[model samples]
Target: MNESLLGALRRAVGEPHVLTGDDCAPFLTDWRKVVTGRAAAVVRPGTTGQVRDVVRACLEHGTPIVPQGGNTGQVAGATPDQSGRAIVLQLGRMNRIRAIDAENDTLVAEAGCVLQAVQEAARAAGRLFPLSLGAEGTCLIGGNLATNAGGTQVLRYGNARELTLGLEVVTAEGEVWNGLRALRKDNTGYDLRDLYIGSEGTLGVITAATLKLFPLPAAQRTAFAATASIEQAVALLARARSMLGAELTGFELMSAVALELVPKHFPDQRLPLPAAPWFVLLETSDAEGESRASERFDALLSAALEAGEINDAAVAQTMAQSKAFWHLRESITLAVAAEGKCAKHDISIPTSRMAAFVTTTDRLLQERFAGVRSATFGHLGDGNLHYNILQPKGQDARSFAATQQDLSLLVHDRVRDHGGSISAEQGIGGLRTADLQRYEDPVKIALLRRIKQALDPRGLMNPGKVLPWQTMP
Candidate 1:
């Protein structure tokens, strides 16, 4: 640890808020428990101005800064490299609900506010902030905006980028760039906010945001069903949309292996299905209240049944029942973790090619790695699928992870073949940076590098993220 950097950080944001020694353990590891890195200190600033000053000092000292929100990101976007010269700019202390406009249906919140906290505040004010995700309890709004996060409600309310009206950011040069204008439409200049949203903090430190909100959904409905295959789930989703239209809010698909592991890990939240090839969880929301929502939902399920899309199904009879249905879908994370060793590939393809993609990947893994247990599931409506594979019984976890590169290539190449993306909701962090260079086109990669150079000339903002320093020949 550099004594000079520590002194600078202390002078900028007080000495007590700067974490050193063993106190920095919690901020060192990412949420997935995959990658762990070291940092000189964790700087917890209480306000946006303090963040600007801290960044400026780090820039002057030629030190790296890892801007962190809730540190709930699945990827190690917030984790620094082995070099302990970097500082973890912890935004958790800057939490505040800046303002809530009931009439405009917009919420101004600091970056450190928990996602669920933002939602609760909106609900209390008789409005809705629809950027819903499984990590709502811990994921911070800043990280969501930083990654342009897509959640279950993306099909209805769009991702965090769309829902966000403005931003307050600290640039790499330690300048406070305030772009917070809460307007519904602005055709003046480039959509600069988009550049920072999914850039994974490489571009800047997102301090706060003005997020758009929506009317409270008066009616809500949920359904869980068994599908013969991924094809059947896709068919049912289209059918539901034809009937429910924009009211369709969430549609998640689950695999038997993924669901099976859920009961194994979270015995309390098990689904009744013993063995099924595939499962689908669909939900709908409307502004008419929960009354008659079940009837409409049941009708949709019946229609899907007669259409031969669903082999078996269940509709929630009440709000409590609806919550339980979602609980089952959200349990996929725990389920995968319980399955021993697994590799996660966050990929997306055109909805039309999903069945073919799933079938091919499953067959390929079985042939290449004997005894490998694979589970394919996630938001089918949006075409983003979590095609994760559990390692074969005899293989060591480390050995299997070494083959992660080969596995990711096999999966991502197929996705690219099908006009899909290797990364969907998950942003490009340290682990994915190498693959981003490997798969991304030359022109696109070059443009990304230019953007990085333009904003972060010194490459000190969030080092070792987004794009790789080297590329394949």
Candidate 2:
């Protein structure tokens, strides 16, 4: 960065908040520990206007700028490149809940506010934010909305995009786009808020948001059931939907391998089953308290078992037991990470085709990469499957990592053939940008490029992160 640009940035955010050298180290890497980059400085802006001024100053000096939130992204979307001339526009100090409208059931919060804080604020107001995720405690709302995050509760409340009401953004040229309207019914032209929702910051930076809220459920019933196969799991979900409808909040699949990994890594979690090939964690919530809800849930499982939709199933006897059972399911991600390097895939298929998708992928994978253990699991309710492959024991994990691109192409091609998405919940960041460009509709890709060119013509906002500027041929 030039001395003039540095001086203007200092003027916008103040010298104490401006970080260089060692201070810029943390913003250079993402949570996955995948890639690291160099930034000239990390500027922490305390307000949206300050962010705007910093951006404008950077634009004037012709210096590149990268807008970052909590930096907990899996795809390295927020990490800058090795240019070292780019400034990391950290929004950490922009954290604040501006206002909450209990009557209209909406809340306005800054981009840097933690997702968990938003949830808690809603809870305190006797409402539910409904955008729950594994990284809710650390991930920023801007990042979640940016990626259109899908969580375990997506079966009920929908993705982060649906839960969002409006957005406030700073465009590449430091112009403000105040699209934050909290109204539910707006026939406003173009639906511009959506443009920035999942654009991965290639167009503009999200400064704040107005989010929709829901009535808190009066009761919740959670269960962990063992199923014979993926087919059985799907059938069980169909039956549950017929009975519970929107009240059915979560339905997560857990293979035996995933369950085993938890106990192997986490200290307190226990294993109850004698190791089955598959399992399911089903959850339901309702606005009214009814003990019969739990009874009905058990009955649904019983029906599934008798109909052979599933072979065996179990319902938690208490809240503690329910949490304990869920501990096994939630720990799968961390446990898998502890096992060392592996090629992880997050893909989606049509809900009706999930069973066939799993069977085909599993069979094909087991056939090709000998001893490459595939621990298939995740939000089967929404067709989002975590098709992760583990390296063989007594072999180098790095060897398996080398085949990631080929495996990704094969997997994404299958998904595309089935009219499924290459990426389901996660956005196409650095990890999947090439695959996205290769498989996404040519016309759609063209439009995306046009939008990027119009808004961020300089390619200064998180460059080389989402859209592929050139075809790989």
C-alpha displacement of 456 in model 2, angstroms? 1.5
Per-model tally of clashing residue pairs: 3, 0
Query: Which regions of candidate 2 deviate over 4 angstroms?
Result: 469-473
In model 1, residue pairs whose N, Cα or C atoms come closer than 3 Å (at least 3 residues apart or on different chains), thus clashing, are: 146-197, 218-289, 219-289
lDDT of 2 at 379: 94
Residues 98-133 of candidate 2: C-alpha lDDT, one tens digit per residue: 999999999998998999999999999999998877
**Number of clashes in model 1?**
3
Give me the displacement of residue 102 in model 2, in angstroms: 1.3
Clashing pairs in 2: none
lDDT of 1 by residue, 1-473 (tens): 77887888898899999999799999999988888889889999999889988998888788889989878777788898887888999999888999999998889999999999999999999999998888889999999998889988877888888899999988988888888888989887888888899988898999999999888888888778998988889899898889889989999989888777776788787685546789988889876766566667888889888988988887777778878878777778867877667888888888999999988887887777667777777888999898888888888888887877777778888888888998889888877887787788889998888888888999887887887655211
Provide the lowest-lDDT 10-residue window in model 1.
464-473
Best by lDDT: 1
Model 2 TM-score on a 0 to 1 scale: 0.96
